[model samples]
Target: MTVFEQRRQALKESLRVRGLPALLVSHAANRWYLSGFELADSQCNESAGWLVITAHGGDTLLTDPRFEEAARRVWSDEIVIYSSRKMEVVGAFLKSLNPPALGFEPRSLCVRDYERLREFVALTPTEGLVEDLRVIKDADEIRRMEASCVLNERVMLALPERLVPGMTEAQASWEVERLFREGGASGLAFPTIVGAGVNAALPHAEPGQDRLPAQGLVLVDAGGRLDAYCSDQTRTFWLGSEPSDRFRHVLALVREAQRRAIEYIRPGAPIAESYHLVRRFFEEHGVADRFTHGLGHGVGLETHEAPSLSSQSRDVFRPGMVVTVEPGLYWPDWGGVRWEHMVLVTEDGCRVL
Candidate 1:
């Protein structure tokens, strides 16, 4: 079934199970997921661009006239469009339907929006009513995400060639972005991190005009997006004549840690175990504290999503789940080494894509 149809079916099932008569999807991403209507930037105005889906399969798209034409062009024929100046009209319309138990996305609705919603209808906070359905990829979603990964991998493979010894970090960053777009990416998944030498110790360092050292370490963390799905990857390189023994040792340990984490990932495996395995590898190298961050995270519509791989995470690895296997060690006096690869969890094991 189409993504929208599947979403509608899932919502219907959720509403039936929860005893809710209708659901209001206010979050932009959730709305896009349910209705396939991309909200215009102006839709964030009070009560505009809201979607109300009834338990009985009725769908309505409420927005201002500014977005009527765009909404018609994008939404399905089943989605009835409502134009109004006052934002309260959406709530009034919902109340007019008089749903017994109205649902709202608890994770997406802010306190301010929740209070505003309370002004019109009784809203029952719903958890994962739509997000749970979105965790698994439909064929089209997977296709777009795979295309995004391909572009990301291509950019990663090409990054080394652009890293001249004297090029500024900002210069290299601009080139990387240019290459991503030229390579068919819609845009960078997030802000690019290009750190050399001492700056490499910072995990999320911003790219700057600092000229790269002729003989030091260079760490690059970047990715790109395609069709709204995202791909993230990180690779640390030796820009000098050759990495020192100390640097090589750190790189080897970090790569080994990342490898072990990926190896331990399988269907039904606890995410904490993978993180612990990475920590153990670092501890063996006497750099446990240097590995501060989580081992990995799920990547899809968002660069970082569910099923985080870390000590605090209780999520179990499942088949068809796309996650990153990244482990690193950073020493303030020295530098940092990180190896990241995006992989798909399978029945047997993870397959890096």
Candidate 2:
């Protein structure tokens, strides 16, 4: 069967086990995962389309009139177009089903939409049904992700050649984006972050017009998307000269933490174990609080996905999973250092992408 078909069958079984006759998939990522329909909304409130999948293998795509032409080209399933009153159209569809239990993604839908949906059917709130299935990548998915990762790595490798001291952070960020596009990436996985000096302390700092430091850290976190798969990597580089003793020490600690985290990745390994390894290393160095964010997250259709690597995460690693191992230490006065790399979880261990 086609990959989309196989995914649909898997989702069907999940719905069956949950005693749900049908599922209303609203998230763009989940929609794409199920039907291979490639469309996204500009904001959380907006929706390009929604999918209604039945246990009997029926797939119906509901979209607005604006997306009618594009939907027709991408989706071969039943297509319904709604104008102003989306709830009315959706309600009609659910009424036709008369399902005793209809599954819907509470995390994906707004309260207003969920409340409206409740008026039409007995809605069952579900989370991660599709995301759980997406954690494990297929061979084709891995191929696309690997290509993206290769493009990302190439862009980083050429940084020394293109980057110069005093170049604006915004300029450097644009250059990285250009490399991704020129190298055949569909688009950026996330905004190219080029943080230098004190600005680097902000983990998700936006690129600014500030000039690159003459001799300190420049943290670059970038990614590209190829065929809807995402590649994410971050590297901290010293400008002009070698880093200070403290900065160098922190960098070494972070790198070691990241190395141990990546080494701990394998099928059946608890996701939290990798995270704890990094946390413990930072704690041992008396900089535990400096590490602010989670170790990493699953990367694929979205830059961040399921099976998060965090202390609170109960998820376990599985073969074919692509995840990042990023350990960082931040200081407002001294700047921040982060090292990120993508790895594919294998049966025994993991392969650095």
What's each prediction's TM-score?
0.91, 0.96
| Regions of model 1 farther than 4 Å from truth | 39-48, 77-86
**What lDDT score belongs to each candidate, Candidate 1 first?**
0.80, 0.89
What is the lDDT for 193 in model 1?
92
Task: Report each candidate's C-alpha RMSD, comma-separated, in the order given.
Answer: 2.5, 1.4
lDDT of 2 at 52: 94
Candidate 1 backbone clash number: 0
Candidate 2 yields a Cα-based lDDT of 0.89
Per-residue CA lDDT of model 1 for 318-347, tens digit only, reads 877888988888888777888899988877
Q: Pick the candidate with the highest lDDT.
A: 2
Per-residue accuracy of model 2 over 203-314 as CA lDDT, tens digit each: 9989999999788889999999888889999999888777799788988999999988887888898899888988888888799999999999889999998778889988
